[model samples]
Target: MPVDQPQPAPPVPPVLPADVELRSPRPEDAEAWSRFLVAAQRDTYGALLPAAFGDDDLAASRIAALESAFAEPGDAARRIAWRGSAVLGVASASAAPADWEVALGLVPAPASRELDRLYVHADAHGTGLGHVLFDAVVDERPHYLWLIDGNERASRFYERRGFRHLDERVSTGPSWGHIPMHRMLRG
Candidate 1:
C-alpha cells in the first residue's frame, strides 16, 4: 500500500499533560542524558528506520555524538520532558548553521530554523512525550528537520503538523547504517 506524503496545514500543537514536566538541560543531566540518547535512538531505529538493527553501532554513535555536543555548550536550546526524575524525551535547536541544510541537502529560507533533534525514550511511547518535546522546541515555526527514511510514525507526526518534505533523500550520517534520509520543511 502507498503512503501519503506530508502536506502543508496549520501547525498541530501538542497537548502536553501537566505531569510531563518540561525543563532545560542541566549540568547534572549529562550522564542520564547520554544514556537516554542512546536508548532513544536504539528504540527508534531498531523499531523504525532500518532493515535490520545493530545495537552496538547505535550505541557507539550515540556515545561519540553526545560526548562531543555536551563537551562545550554552544548556541542551542534543549528541552527535556520528564516524569518526576526520569527523562522522558529531549528536543533541541541551534542557530541555523551552514552545511546543516547542506548536510541534509535542504536549503531553508533565511526565515527558517533547524530543529537539531527530537527524541523520546522508547518506553515513553504513547504517553505523548514526543509531542510535548516537539512543542517546546519547534512548535510549527518555519523550520526543517531530517526525517529518517521509512519512519512512518514520525512522518505522520510532522504531516499532521503541516510539515512537507523536499522530496529528496540524502544517504547520510552513521545512524541506521547511514540510511536514506530526507528533509521536511514547514513555515
Candidate 2:
C-alpha cells in the first residue's frame, strides 16, 4: 500500500472586483508586466519552449519585443487594466504581417489587424477583465485571431465573445502539441 500526497491549497480568490480602469500601457509598466506574464504563462502552461526558440529567457525577450513594437512606426496600441498601481490585465492588437497567412495558412492575404496578446492575472480571472479586454481589442480594430487548438479556455472565451470558426487544420508547437482551430471575429 502507498500513501498519497496532499494537494496544494487553492489560490486565494481576488478581492478586487471586475471593474478596472483601462488605459494605455506605459514604459513604467514593463517590469511588472513582464513578471506577471512570465508567471502567468508558467502556471497555465507547464513550461515555455517554442521549437527550442523560447525558454526561461523568453519572458524578457517578449518584454523587449513588446516595448519595441509599441514604440515602432504605424498604428499600434496597448491597453492595461489597473487597480491603482497594480496591473490586472493587458490587451493589444496590431497590423498583421503581410506574410502571416502564407506562413500559417494555405491561403495568403493581408489582415487588417491581429490580436497579438491578452493576459489577465490568475487572481483576476473570472472577474470580467477578460471580457473587458476582449471588447477593448475588438473596438480598436476589426479583425480575427488564429487560436491554437489545445487552448480550450481561450477558444471558448473567443466563441462566447462572437468569434466564428474558419478552419480545422492542425499545427504543432515545440513543447505543445497539435492545435487545430481557425477563428474569425465579425460584427
Candidate 3:
C-alpha cells in the first residue's frame, strides 16, 4: 500500500534556539553523547536495561556502533544533531544486514536504508526531532525501521508519520524485554 508522506512541521520556538547544527560526531562528543544516552534510556526505553548498560560507559559502546557505520570511506554517514555542544539526536545507517538478521526482518540492502537507531534527548521530546530524522532517512530512499509493540508512544508516532506494519514479531529477554511490533517505513 502506498503511504502518504507526512508533512514536516514549521519551525516553532525550540527550547534551545541556539544555532542548531547537524554534523558528524567527533571524539570530543564522547561525553555529550554519553550524557544524551542517560536521557535516552530514562525517557525512551524507560530504564529497562541494567545499570551497566544504562550508564555512561554504554554511551561509547553505542556511539561506537554508529561510528562503525561511518568507518567506511564512502556512502556512509553518522549525523549527530546538535544544539551547540549538546547532542540532541543521532541518525545513521549501514549496509543492511540480511532479512533474518535484522529485527522484524528489515532488509536494509537492495536499495534500502535501515534506520538502526534514531533517538532524541528527553528534553527535546515532542520537538519534532524524530520527524526530522525520519524524513532524512526516507528522503534517502527505500528505508525501514522496526517499531517494538509495547512502545505505544513510539509506535503511534511512526504510524502517524506513515510507517505501516509489515510484520508482527516478539522479542524476549531480561534486559531486552519482549517487543511485539510492526515494521513500517516510507519509500
Candidate 4:
C-alpha cells in the first residue's frame, strides 16, 4: 500500500469587522474621501508612481475630480466602506466606455463593465475591507479593470477572484508621469 500524503490546508478568507458599513457616497464625504484616497494612494502607489503622488497640485486636482465625481456620479455605481465615522475604502463600477474599448483594441461586449476604482486604506488591508468593497460593487460578473503593471498584491487579489491579464497596456500620460497599466478581465 502506498503511504498517504498530507494535504495542505485551504487558504483562509479574511473576515470583515462587524463595525464596518458600506454605503453610497454622500456630499459630506467629499473631504474625508479625498484625504482617504490620497493617503491610500500614497501607501499603495507612491513608490510605483512617485511623481504623481509627490506633486501637490496634481493631488489637489485629483481630489477635486473625486469630489466632482461624487457630486455627479453619472452612470457609475460607487460604494464607500466605513467603520463608524472613518472612511475605510472605496470602489466604483460603470459601463465600459466604447472609446476605452476601441483604445484598448478590445471587442466591446454589450454587458462589459469597468471596475473604475478600488482603493482600501492601509489600516483596513487585513480586515477583509477590500473583499467587502469589491463584492459590493462588481461581484462575480464579467467585468474588467486596469491596474498598475507591477502591483503584485492587487494582482494576486484579482487573480484569486478570477481576473486574468488580457496582455493589453495603457499609459496615464504625462500628468501621471506616464505610469504603465495593464488590463485584466473576468468572464
Q: How accurate locally, in lDDT, is each candidate?
A: 0.71, 0.64, 0.61, 0.78
Instruction: Give each model a TM-score.
Output: 0.70, 0.67, 0.67, 0.75
Mark the regions of model 4 whose C-alpha exceeds 4 Å error after superposition.
1-15, 50-74, 98-111
Error of 4 at 3 (Å): 17
lDDT, residue 154, candidate 3: 77
Question: Distance (Å) between predicted and true CA of 165, model 3?
Answer: 1.4
Candidate 3 lDDT: 0.61
Stretches off by above 4 angstroms in model 1 are: 1-19, 47-75, 98-111
Better of 1 and 2 by lDDT: 1
- How far residue 181's Cα lies from its native spot in candidate 4, in Å, is 1.0
Q: Give the TM-score of candidate 3.
A: 0.67
lDDT of 1 by residue, 74-186 (tens): 86667877778888888987667446455654554433577777888767777777777777777545777778888898899888767888778777555457778877877
Question: Least lDDT summed over 10 consecutive residues: which range in candidate 4?
Answer: 49-58
Quote the lDDT for 37 in model 3.
56
Model 2 bad stretches (over 4 Å): 1-21, 47-62, 98-110, 175-181
Clashing pairs in 3: 149-180
Count of backbone clashes, every candidate in sequence: 0, 0, 1, 0
Candidate 4 residue lDDT tens string, 1-187? 9999999998676667778878889766767777777677778766656554645633666667767878898877889988899888989898885465677565664347889779998877767888878887895568888888888999999998988897666785555567888778898
